[model samples]
Target chain A: MTNIEINTYLTFGYLLWIIAYLVAFVAFRDRARSGAIFRAALIVLLCIHTGSIVLRWVESYQMGIGHAPLSNLYESLVFFSWSVALALIVVWRRFGTDLVALLGVPIVFLILASTFLIDPNIRPLIPALQSNWLVAHVFTCFLGYAGFAVSFVAALLLLVARSSAKAAELLPGKKLLDEIVYRSILIGFPLLTLGIITGAAWAEHAWGTYWSWDPKETWSLVTWLVYAGFLHARLSRGWSGGRTALLSVVGFCAVMFTYFGVNYLPGLHSYF
Target chain B: MKKSKTMETGSSESVSILFQIKAFFTSVRTTVFLLFTIALGAILGTVVPQGEPLEHIAMSGNTFLYRLALILDINNIFRSWWFTSLLGLLTLNILGCLFQRVPSIWQDLRGRNPKTSFKLHFRSSLTIAQLKDRLVPVGQEIMRAAPVISGTRDTQHYSWVKGRIYLIGFPLIHIGIIVILLGSVIGAFWGYKGHMMIAEGDSSNKFALIPSGEARTLPFTITVDGFKLVKYPTGEPKEFRSNVRLTQDGKDMLTGSILVNHPLTYEGISLFQADYKVLGVKDVKLSFKTKEGEDLVKVADPRHDIDIPGTDVKLKTLSLDPGTIAQGPGIQVSVPGKSDKPQLVSIYQKDKRPLNIDGVEIRFLGFTPLYATGLQIGYDPGVRIVWLGCTMLVLGFILTLFTNLQKLSIELGGSSKGTDVAISGRSRKLRKEFRQKVEGAFAGITELRRET
Candidate 1:
């Protein structure tokens, strides 16, 4: 499909998801009365998301040398949010919605916005990226990033829950938000780790040395450290809720730098 | 024997000292601080040109600032001691954090319920009194409840439920963190990196090693057999590539065309196609002298005076540098012992003019263009550790998110009218969701009881 066609589908999916989210938020007023409507809207948005992804996949195939729609910045953001959507649905199903979705939706929107900064022309990857590890690395990393985004938002909500007694009435209290945030980071961290590992392996294959301290690589390390701190903070008794959430926010900013700022940075990583 | 014993004792003392040092490094705060500093250094490195000589920045701007930047090695941050130490500190911090935290987490995971507060609470979960209501006698029942729904207090009608696969998730988290640290550390310690500029038709693997103190060397020879720049109609490069080979024992080990990003690798070493430069056809040249009978010598270069072993005839170029005068592309030629105003012999792109040096003669050789291909060379031993660290970190994170110790306990006392249900829950990390799950579980129970 052409860029216009793909974007049209994407825009439609984006609208559908937003509508579903709003429906769910409004439906929460009387949950019993709104279950059917919420489920229906959610199903529509999810189905639309799946369809859009499939179409994108098909579009790549039509270009002859098929790609995973993740070779560039815009594609990465879109894919990231898509993974978040799918994973969030699974989380909602297995764990039941306890206002975690509230934390998840904004992340989806942010990822969508990231697409604007990224070039959406669907260009081929450089010769350096023509390795088996590229798929494994990007897939796992973006998925991990999406998971972290969810956790970050959840962590924010957790602080909100803790700060105000009024927040306790809204599905998740501070404790629940903390757990969800921790859980999100837990899932995201491993994926990030996998992503980094795969990237290193690929780097070794392509650049001879695995760690080059490239801006992208360094920022990735920075991202890892913040999450590591978050995990370690648990042992010290007081790095949870707001502080942990704040750290997570900082990590995502690092993530953005690694992904986008590297190109602008005066380093070998600028090529990527 | 006494000397041996003393040696052992001294060794043990040193070992103890080492252990103390290791212990100090393993602290959480140290790791955090290390990460912070490394992050700061990395930010600096990104903002500045890593490993670039000050000449580069000076080539671009102000003398004072350039000199200062040069002094600070801002252009060469990654390889500098201060920056490297920050990285080392970051690695140490990770090790330290693991050293201090893993054991405790493991103990928490391994610590069995030895009639402790946890066991007491576990027993107080909602299965005991409810069992009496069911047909299964409180003492002996035929069926057991689901895992998520089984617990009892220390009353006479209670039974301890062993639902702890979920409780055993902390190790996975710890293991993941450790693995990630291992990967990064391995990468840091075990890798080597360098760069080379291989010209077309060049065979020597004399890679121009980057100045990295002690850790540098080429394990094998990489030859640039040839390079071609295929251009578009617009004169832009459509594709540029170099024929490359890794050779050993006079045998080619690997051969391929390396283009942008498509590097060639031998064993574990890879040569990246980093960059290329245009040459001004002066790198190699051919020279000839019309001898007594034949075009005796098609000398590759005139710098090396070729002696026919037994003949007194020898030819040498007086000048070998980029010599192209306004009128003629000529080199000042000379003969041994009898140098009379060294012959100014002109050479052309294609040999056209012959040198008439009174009685001597010279011919223009073909031009050799200076072709330089930039190759990035690297070897890293710490990469595997880095990869391992990444794995651990990833697994730890996933476990933290996907799994949790979900526990709910309630003690019900018969009050002749109805039973009182006290509900409470505890989770290791994410308390918020744990509370909600417990509350939801209670609500579900209330709904079930009401329906019944």
Candidate 2:
């Protein structure tokens, strides 16, 4: 299929995810058969989403530009939504439940919607971006972002489930929710560290400086410090429950700012 | 006796002072506070335009805010005294925290038993005779299941600990951070960065500093032999390379080429191809045709005069424009004998542009573009140390995040019916998961007991 057709398929996949999540939420509330149907549909949509991304990459090759579909804002957002979907599937399969998917679905939808708002046209790579490091850097960074997104959703659920009995009944136990948040951070932190290191290596090659204290770099460091604080407090201070949840939420906010807000500030990384 | 008493008091007073100082820096609360403050400063640095001149910031129309920024050194916050002091304080705090915790962590690792408050009671039974044979096999199984540090056997008990060695990764990570900070300090004091632009076939031994623009001469001279710019079919730049030769004491030292993302290093100095610029025409070949059906060709140098073969009209080359929208070169020429004003004449390599100057027709033939390569030169003695620290930091993170300290204790008591086995364990991280594994091991041991 053409790239445009692939994009259409992706849009359809996101819609299907939302619908399936709604079904799963209902199933969670009422203990109905819809949960099984939702699970089947989710698997189907994930396959289609993965195919769409692969097709986009193929289309780039056919056009002879021949880069991964991850060099621009539009492609990164689409990749991000796909990552969130993959994380949701993994969390669901590992936990044997779709409770967290109720929170995950909306985030993927929002990001996919934002993707549509930006340009999706495939462009040739600039000389600065024409390196193998681009693939490693962007892929690892987005995966880290996806992990934090999942953790944010889990943290939000933890806060809500702890306060309201109705929410608690519909969700997993508070302990499990906390565990999910911590697990997600455990997955993201190392990936983020790798991403930063790869970016530094790339910078050394492209700009002759390993670290320039650019706005994007500084902001990434800030995000790292915030999460480091969270992990430190949890591991050493024995912090858990609401305080850890709050830290996760705050950490994700910092992540969002580093990803989106830094674009407006003038820096060397403005090529987003 | 009086003097000894005085000395004791003095020593005690000094000891208390040291205790208070260590207590202040070793507090976890101080660490969290320092992290918060550093993060805040970094945010401010990113939000405000940094490294700009004071006058330029003042011209942005917020006089009071600019003054306040100047007072707070926000214009260069990353290198400002306060920010640097905060970093220094953080390094000290980490060192202090490591000092205080090392003793305790060492003590915990050395202690034989788990630090749990739970107590175990042992009793003998009929299967006490089989316990001796089962003890070795059970201990082996536990060691195989996890990373066991040590195993001990008693008459009725078998115990082993796994991953206790990984506890050192925590302190190693803190030490790595300090190493990184030290590297930064060394870089700040000793490193230098400068920029130099060398035209093709030119040489220079001096460059201007990046911040202050002060020219500094190096002990060696660098010569640019050639500069090449390659473009894609789309007319976008693909690569820029500069061939350079270094000379020390008027003798050839090294010859190499620097490209984008590739650099040349010699004698602890590195040169990077940061940018390039095209100069005016080097030489131009022009053909002039007279109305008498005769051809006159002359090669003209830019900024030089050329005489027409059959007329008093003199063609003087003024300047050349590397065509922006049109891909060919355009030459500006002046007819000194005919018109005093210089006229811009377009030239194309494929399609010739004929200009009639005072009734003498001149066709532009060919042109060459000269370029200069801009190089960013840096000398940093601390870069290797920084890279080493980075490597250590990643390794420490991997060890600390992925591994945990675990200890498992099994107490087997022989009862009148059979042997009753109780298994309990503790983990530094992921305790719940460790407990489940211990329970699984316990079930396996029970199955073995029945089989035997």
| Candidate 1 per-residue C-alpha lDDT over B117-235 given as tens digits, one digit per residue, 9 for 90 to 100 | 22121212335456334312321221134322334444332332333444434555555555655555555566556777777767765555556544444767778887776654445
Taking the tens digit of each residue's C-alpha lDDT, what string does model 2 give over A1-272? 66656766667676766776675565565544665666677777778777878888888898878888888888888888888888888887777556687678778878877776777787777777776777788898889888888888889989999889997987788988888888888888878877887887777676767778899999998888888878778776788889989989998999889889998887768777
Q: Candidate 2 on B1-452: residue-level lDDT in tens?
A: 99999999999999999988888799777788788789999999998888888888789898886986777888889988899999999999999899888987897678554575232333334364475455446555755662233333433555666676677787877887888778767877998889998889999998999878999997799999988887866777777889999999889999999987677888888888889888656678888888786898777776778877667777777777556555565676766532565555555544444777656778777776678889998887877777777787778778777777777666666545666655556777776676666555445533343322
Number of the top candidate by DockQ? 2
Candidate 1 residue A45 Cα shift, in angstroms, is 2.5
Scored against the true structure, residue A133 in model 1 reaches a CA lDDT of 81
Off by over 4 Å in 2: A27-37, A56-64, B1-18, B54-67, B104-126, B132-139, B145-157, B283-316, B322-329, B334-366, B411-422, B444-452
Scored against the true structure, residue B220 in model 1 reaches a CA lDDT of 74
Write down the C-alpha DockQ for each prediction.
Answer: 0.27, 0.58
Candidate No. with top lDDT: 2
RMSD of each candidate?
11.5, 4.6
